[model samples]
Target: MFEKVDPQYLLEGVDGFIQEEVSYNLFYLITGFEEALTIKSCDSKVLFAQSPRGNPWLWVNRDLPEEERENALKLLIEYLDETPLTGVSSEPRTAEMFANLYGARYHTSIKRRMDMEAYACPQVVKPEGVSGCLRSAQLGDVETVAQYLAGFSEDGYGIVVDPASQMEAAEIMVCKGGLYMWLVDDRPVSMAQIAHRSPRHGRINAVFTPRNERRKGYAGAVVSGLCSILLGEGLVPMLYADMVNPASNRAYQKIGFIQSGQISDIRFE
Candidate 1:
């Protein structure tokens, strides 16, 4: 039996942030409609020692608590040792640079060396009724969207899991994201997610529509509309599309998103 975790208390430690088990999956129940959680998290693959030194980042938030923050770094360091990771990435949780992930120093280093490439941001249109509208999603829309996403299996992107598992996971993403859904006449349609919100940039997650819903000008509108909102909010928008899909690449191109970098998925032992 699982005891419901208190958000305030569980966020007290690094393990809490890395492997937070909430009462009712608040992130999903709350976000309305999100891109769904499909990242390669060891969240379910491994168990944590109560006082483990290292942590993992399950959620990306600026207002992370003290216990969770410190522990998360410890967890990140530990996890790095176990997994064959290329990018020793970390987020700037604080000002002191106690443990630098991708802090000011690292950014400065990359800048000074001229190793990092410069890139422009993507801009999506805003959602509204009539032409292009983005409304908050409901529980009922979950099944439909979930079914549509199953088509994007690991066979293609090197990320695979049972479709049923994907649906269960998506529930959590929608809630934590305050997700917004696109609809037509009472029927749920396309979906987009908002994340990485900040002064520098905001990331867009899982912009998708059903296979049947494709070519109807839905995705173009959704991506554009969402990007527009982020731009309006003074945040540069970014996203990664499967390079394999020429159609998708074209869609983003139409919206003014330039090629950022070569994102690869390496699954090896």
Candidate 2:
């Protein structure tokens, strides 16, 4: 059995479970889900949370016995009958199990993803002649950030996203002091964002360097700088990377990130 609960309440109930494999959804739950929705199993062993009208993700406690997971999945299906869900992001086993039992057609096959965390700052080597410093992105950088965000989506995920929407998101990030950039002669060359942050953890994401800036070490420099700052704030830096992208994964590893575990991103058509 499951019961609908306020997201604020769910946050307290699942705090320990989310730490098992902290991800964007976790940060969003903590930092941005004031108006979101939540549900938990009657035993409080499983949780499902989502942004308003957005896709919901599952988070099951590792200690929850196998039988509990089975029962929770059934309850989750019944709950979904009333609340539409377009996707699920969770540990590979949990997400796959839910998708199969829910009869949600596999819209996109599961992709292998790595969850990584950094304990110490990485030693970064700046390319010769690439001189600049890292700084928080200002509101004036919206155009540049928006363009790079769109390019990143296309290049990194092979998905086309609306530039307007990207700009809106970039504006929010800049205002929140979440966006950072590497500039040369006052011109932005590479950028990264603190995607989701908790008091003890911060996730680096949306890393991008223009094609002309590629291989010049800007991406590495910006990410390394961000990780160092997050560490200074007493927060462990973490990030997620597609296992298919060796270069991206290698870049993060070079910044002292070690593989923690794997998760799955599945979309239902």
Q: Estimate each model's TM-score.
A: 0.52, 0.83
For candidate 1, lDDT tens digit of each residue in 106-164?
33222111011112354553323335577765666666656645655542345555667
Overall lDDT per candidate, in order of appearance: 0.47, 0.72
| Best candidate, lDDT | 2
lDDT of 2 at 171: 86
lDDT of 2 at 137: 97
Candidate 2 runs further than 4 Å off: 13-21, 24-32, 104-130, 161-166
Off by over 4 Å in 1: 1-132, 154-163
Candidate no. 2 TM-score: 0.83
